[model samples]
Target: MRRITLWLMSTVAAVVLLFSYRTSTMGATAPDTPGVVGAAPGVVPGGPAPGPSAGSSAPPGSTVVNGTVSQTRWGPVQVRVTISGGRITDVVALQVPSGNRRDREINSNAVPALRDAVLRAQSADFDSVSGATVTSDGYRRSLQAALDAAHFGS
Candidate 1:
């Protein structure tokens, strides 16, 4: 009886936490806080969609490079980096770990956060997404590859 009571209490607590979080975040109503769930400064939606641009030509004053594809448990993670004026101009996710609706949702939320962090830090050393550590690591590695290819210093 005591074990059952404890288990039931724990379940109830977990449910409460879940709903509270959902209620707080479901609407995306929070103000833009950059490097969080909101868009980063100078970032465009679907920014520079990632792709293979290695050895390919980009417009003068700007260059695009593709990162290595990182395979995660859910799927693969890949990205592209844009460089101009010796600085990182943008990041775009070409491929993400998406094998199901849950995967899609998780990646969807994580990618933006990762991008924002990368742009802000101008490096691969950014905070991992709250619920997407695997994807985050893959993204960091892939982003680093693109930066290396571009010979980016910062």
Candidate 2:
């Protein structure tokens, strides 16, 4: 009886502890900061490269546009696209969720893939990263917005 009781108590305590643990996703709210479309102030080592400044002039037939901020459950996602000669020449993620280690890891893997896919497909209708669905969705939304802002492909 004593052994069983001790085991039961330990199990109950473990369960309680597990239930009380907080995750980065719990009760989090998206930030209100608007996305910056120009040469960002600082660059994340493993994150997207900075695009040209909004005030800078694109080549005669090229255009640069910043996507709207997309609020995901983890955080906001945004991108900037440069279209040259009527094709998507480059893509830069202006903002991506980096609230925690996991966010950073997921995006570090996902953002580059998304950017490459956009450049190849020349649109936002591309396959999302396997383990980063949320981030991918936000990326697509922002990419589409940027394309629209630039009047790309239409």
Candidate 3:
């Protein structure tokens, strides 16, 4: 009887510890920040990059965009979004850190809203993602940065 009781208790303890560790790790979020651009860092703290040349082949209204989306706990997430003639041409998730489950969850939750925002975007103004506000905001900022780059040829 005594041996059985000890074994049960040990099992319970192990299960609790495992559960705690998993949850704790899963709860962490990534950071939000600007990233490198065209062989140069994209998110320079001071300001944006220089515009494209006048003779460049890119269409007059077409834009090429690139930036990063990061969560608070983890590293940054690099993203690229292109807009042309006031419409979203592409949305890309570039670089996301590994091991942070929350970041993935946040991304999953925000994807729909992000898509809507891109589709409905007018002058880079759009709503935030529902469940993952921070992640959504980060993504939005990055998208906006990319849009700016595309429009202004930065």
Ranking by TM-score: 2, 1, 3
Model 3: lDDT of residue 152: 39
Q: Residues 65-153, candidate 2, lDDT per residue (tens digit)? A: 77787888788787877787778888888778877778888889999999899888989999999999988999999888877776677
Q: Which stretches of candidate 1 lie over 4 Å from their true place?
A: 1-59
Off by over 4 Å in 3: 1-62, 68-74, 96-98, 152-154
Query: lDDT rank, highest first?
Result: 2, 1, 3
Q: What is the lDDT of candidate 1?
A: 0.68
Among all windows of 10 consecutive residues in model 3, the one with the lowest summed lDDT is 45-54
lDDT of 3 by residue, 98-146 (tens): 3466666667656756766766664446777676665566666666666
The alpha-carbon lDDT assigned to residue 37 of candidate 2 equals 32
Q: What is the lDDT of candidate 3?
A: 0.54
- Candidate 1 lDDT, 1-154, residue by residue in tens: 9999999999999998987764322323331223222221231122342233324444466767777777665566777787877767778776775545576788778988998998899888888989999889989988888887767884
- TM-score of model 1 vs. true structure: 0.62
Instruction: Name the weakest run of 10 consecutive residues (lDDT summed) in model 2.
Output: 39-48
lDDT of 1 at 91: 81
